[model samples]
Target: MEQTPLEIQLKTLPESPGVYQFFDREGKMLYVGKAKSLKKRVSSYFNKRLENGKTRVLVGKIDSIRHIVVRTESDALLLENNLIKEHQPRYNILLRDDKTYPWLCIKNERFPRIFPTRKRIEDGSEYFGPYTQMRTVRALLDLIRSVYPLRTCNYDLSEEKVAAGKYKKCLEYHLGNCLAPCEGLQDEASYHNQVDDIREIIKGNFGASLTYFRHRMKELAVEMAFEQAQAIKEKIEILENYQAKSTVVNPKIDQVDVFSIVSDPTHAYVNFMQVSHGLVVRSHTMEIKKKLEEADADLLPLAILELRERFNSDTRELYLPFPVSLPEDLKVVVPQKGDKRKLVEFSERNARFYRQDRFKQIRIIDPDRHVKRLMQQMKTDLRLSEEPRHIECFDNSNIQGSNPVAACVVFRDGKPAKKEYRHFNIKTVEGPDDFASMTEVVHRRYRRLLQEGESLPQLIVIDGGKGQLSAALKSLDELSLRGTIAIIGIAKRLEEIYFPGDPIPLYLDKKSETLRVIQQLRNEAHRFGITHHRNRRSKSAISSVLEGIDGIGEKTARDLLRKFKSVKRIRQASVDDLAEVVGPSRARKVYESLRE
Candidate 1:
């Protein structure tokens, strides 16, 4: 066989680490991939038999290939991630939630101000974290404020200005939130000491501040300054409390980045934890959607690079669930025992939890996707040949053999299709015979659909036990539709499901989506039936009361009820108002009867 243009291009590729692109006949980019060896990776597409069907299909559409050589695998990884983000090729892993997390900044100046920021600039300032939440940042800032009287104003507290006394103390100074550094009331050395303590605390090291306060308290106590010593004791307590709340691990495991990933057929969730002095100073979880069948190994390394850059992480040591290919300068440790192992497990748990939470949120926000998943689940659980996209549930409602009626609630794509619902008056059934009423309604519903040439439901659910199910089958038999439509009956007790010929009930898990959807349909049908039954009883009561009068008939009674809304309202109406509704003679009779 002659080599194609793609094969020739692949043969000419270099052995160095690089990024590769596949394009189709129409010059549309099909996929983007990174490899340690350009020639080896590009040739493998043609030499190796790809297991994933999606990859095989993608390969078949490849009309040409391109490559960009890089200095190292890490460089290739970064370039690939960037290209995937920019082009969003059909066969690259796509990250859906890639927003930058916020970091706490301490400016590099006299009387430096501290605040939370999302942007990382190249100015001479120190950044603490790209925290997962703003709430965490705020809580840390509050703790710092309580412990130290730091200035909150954005002022240029230069040495010259302070010497000249160019500025005055503001509200923060009077409120005790600041030490009035602008007015030269605060000592430069003391303010710088406080700033150093704050830097240590933010780095997850509280020992320095605690030691300083303890020494200060000892000195104050020795000098017989009891009041100042007491104040220093309180400050120590606040710092210790804040430290206790923040620490989650042993202090020995310091200055490391932790990563763990959880993936499915179509997506991967990666969770990152930045540990400093055994405390989780920063944590985040990101979700990536796979356009191709990419594994966790392929996705995690790229994600680590992106997240590290985004968070401005500088830790050289990393704790991961598994070893990944990274730059030689970085140390990767796959912990198997002790606190490090536990930290890895914790990161994995976070990733799993985040994946589950993201799925739940998606179901809530995207109803169509939720319904599609439910329908597919129902199809598998029930062993149906096709998805039950259109389902109709029948329920009978009656009050002690009076006002018997039935309701059929239609669900299209796992949601209540209200307009497709119907109410039946139990025309052929006597008394409150539920089984007979179900049969009559089923027959009437499908018979009319067949006559009108309308589409039929994929599944029929009768809200009763085997007897009611058999009755509904009888209607389908009459219509020559038995075994053509999927039918089941749900017993109210224990929520058992009955089929046509099976004597044993099929009991689904109580928390299964199929069972929940069935229950929703049954409840909706019952509610709909009860409403119609109530209306029928009220109408019958009004008709009987009005027809008892001498001059009134059935139609006249209906007209009177329709015009006045109810019998009480009709009775409340004046004789002239009643005359306009039911005419002169009947109005007089009605008015007199009510009055008497």
Candidate 2:
């Protein structure tokens, strides 16, 4: 058989690191990917069966392939990221942060004036940030102004212009906020020195500024200028306070970027923390809209490059939640213990919180999208064939083998459907046989649903361990619905989830939304079962005590009990009092029965 052009291309491709682009029939880019071996990676699309539906579709749409060989895997990663952004292939994840972050720019001038800006120009001016929050920029600016008193006006403070006395200080000079640098009241050298200190502070290095202020304060105190010394003291306090608030870990840990990611089926949230001298100077959580079912390993690198570029972070050191491919020159630490690990965990917490907040907002604004995302998350977590939009949980309740009953609680769209809840009395299986009771209820519940032509639940939760799960499976097998509905059992002690024939249980994270929902279902079922069990026990006791008497029927017993709220009170009631409720003939019989 003759080989096709794609097969020939795949065979002839280099085994080196490279980026590959997939194009559709009409020459539109479908997807862009990076690989350590172009021959193996690109060939994988045709050779392997892609599990992700979107990836399978993307592969089906590919008409031609192109490759750009790189020297190293890291170079290939960077190129793939750049190509994805440049062309925005249909099957690539998109970094969704479009907000204009504020930066502290030091204007290019004789006496540089520093201010916050949203734009960066190609002039020789220095821009410190591209910070994640405007408030941080403002606070830094306010701190620098209070301590340094630099000029706010963007005047041409040239030497000749100042010598010619072409400018005058405004109310800023009167208020002592500026030293009148425009009028040469402050010298060029002194203003430049202040600018140097401000630059250090913006880089999250407060040592230079703090040392300068402390030295000045000492000089003023030595000269018996107590008021000026106190003023310097206040400036030192401000710098020290800000540094204290910003610093998070060991001050020796400097120039490192921390990245952590939390993701769902539709989106991924990546938190970036720019650490300088252990201070988290800039922290941001960005959401990425997934075009395919991208994993964390794929999404993290793209986000790392995009965020580092956007924030102008040149730090070669990174603290991440997991290992990833990057340039050999860059240090990547997947911290396992101690402060570095704590920092990574902190970033992870921020990403999770951001994801939850987005969920809350979406739930309020667009409930359908929120529900869809939640269902998708649950489906993935539980390894289900489809979304568990309608779920049922079963629990058996019996105290001392008396009133053995089962309660089935229904949840529609993650909320309890109270009207659909049903309770069952133990018919064939008696005593405290939880497993048998579970089998009977599950069999009966679905048997009726099948008989009535009602829809079955996507998931069934049995609130017990392997034994109960096995019992429930037997019922499903009898109904021939074993493969039709997904079922799992939850153990109460460890919150372990068990599947049929799978001995090893799955333990979800304590904070997982899926575990929370499962717990809610289990607890509701238990509560409902306990309530029904208690009611049955009360009714049985009443029947045994009152209905056991001869010639005292259920109606007379009910009438007597209604008049006296409790069985004990009914026993204490006089014959005349009982007659007022029931007739005198039945009243005497009831009175005699109570004494007995």
Candidate 3:
């Protein structure tokens, strides 16, 4: 027995942390993964009996193996993340949410101003969150305004200008929203103290600001300033109300980042929440597309790094639903019970809802993309060489031996191309022969296309079982197109898909988009064929009834039909009315035939 290339590579793999890649025979990357021990991890794919069906398929496609040795597990993790993102290997999890969330920033200036922003600059500014919901940011800002009076002007408030009275009090001051720092009514020390308290509040530490307000209210009451005391009392109440509404966990479990993940077969949704003083100050959910089959352990760390950098978060501790490998400097905890556990669960709920909302939005807004994805899925599931962007389905319709017709319905990008639909009268087929009808229509369709140099569909679907499928193949063989285009037959009973030269049928999941599109194609073809068949049968009946009269010719029968519209109407018309259209001699014959 000869040793294979994979076995040879496995024997030489170093017992160290590294990243590995698998390639199929055609040099396409199949999967990319990281390993703490290259020898053990790389060997496990072949050494163990894989349980996952997709994993088994991936392994079966592996024609070559490659590995890159790294210094440590963290380095391996980073290398794996970068490779998966760059190559988008068929087996890695890729985050699809590319939109950056908004953050609340306190500008680095005298009398600092706070606002929501999407971009982060290197300038000296304090940013609080990359919150998913802009409404939450707006509500927080509104709450802050109710408690503290802050300037809203864009002014260079230098000491010399204020001392020189270069600027006067603005509307902000008149409206009691500012203390007029430009006019020197607001001292630098006093303004800095208020900005500091706001910074703490934004960080989810409300105790300091609340304590200061309570003490000031008491001082105002002692000095017998009743009005100012009541004002201060309202500020305290506002701050307390915000704190009560924001806090969701034990106050002791503060200054931590929380993450939870929910995944489907093709994508993963991750929710991140920043906890400060047990309050969820920032919350966001990101959707990640899976390339190969990356798990939560692979996706969560990358999301953590991205979110923390985006939000300017420096929290040292993280609360996660599961343990993950990360840098030694950051602590990861999986809470079992109490408030921390509830916080994790809350984050998971957010992820689940976000996934559902995203699905609905995609179906409504980007229907083309959704359809394209469905076509791609069908391409993969059916093992077609290309996406079925343009598909044609054939169905035969007949009643006993009276009228035989076949309809070819064209679908472009998973939508009905109504104008391109064609109907055939089944000229060569006799009786109610479905296989012969399918053969005639398939041959005539592509033969004309070949003659006119028109493009052929990527796929052809036949609405019947193996007998009809074999008949279709016979026509393809005559046109020398046996293998040029993909063709499949779908049985009406079980919806089994039959391929040329294959006996076993492919049964797609009932709820799969691929199956739905195929069913749509089948149903459309049947409807089109049935409609044409009914019209043809009606026309034949009218021709037989009208032409069989003694004095009527084809032209006279046509004229009568043209005037009366239908056979039933022509029969109902009186001889005088018919004479006005077809003359009295032919009219009497038609009238007597109707009477007979």
lDDT of each: 0.82, 0.83, 0.81
Give the TM-scores of the predictions, in the order they appear: 0.45, 0.57, 0.47
Candidate 3 structure lDDT: 0.81
lDDT string for model 1 (1-596, tens) is: 75555645665566777678888999787888889988788888889889999889998999987665555675465456545655678776553236444567888887788898867665777776545467878989988888889998887899998889889899888898998989888988999888888988886679988888899999999999999999999988877776422224444677999999987555788888887644455556788988787889999999999999998999999999898999898999999987689888867866765565555655555567666657767887777778899999999989899988899999999889999989988888878788888889999999999999999888999999999999999999999998778999999999999988999999998967689999999999999999998989988998998999997899898899889988899889999999998888889999999777
Position 546, candidate 2: lDDT: 88
Residue pairs with backbone atoms closer than 3 Å in model 2 (clashes): none
- What are the clash counts of all predictions, listed in order? 0, 0, 6
- Cα lDDT tens digits, model 3, 1-596, are 65665666666567777678899999888887889998799899999899999999999999987665545575455455545644677776452234344567888887788888867674777766545457878888887887878887888888887889899898888888888998989888998888888877876779889888899999999999999999999888777777422323444566899999987556788888876643444566778898977888899899889888987989999999999988899999999986689778877866765565555555555677667667767788889999889999999989997788999999998889999999999898768888888889999999999999999999999999899999999999999998899999999899999999999999998967689899999999999999999999998888888888887889988898898899889889999999999888878889999889
Q: Model 1, residue 35: what's the lDDT?
A: 94
Q: Which candidate is the best by TM-score?
A: 2
State, as a TM-score between 0 and 1, how close model 2 is to the true structure: 0.57
The candidate 3 region of ten consecutive residues with least summed lDDT is: 243-252
Best by lDDT: 2
Preferred candidate (TM-score higher): 1 or 2? 2
For model 2, how does the per-residue alpha-carbon lDDT over 452-533 read when each residue is reduced to its tens digit?
9999999999999999999999999999999899999999999999999899999999988899999999999999999999
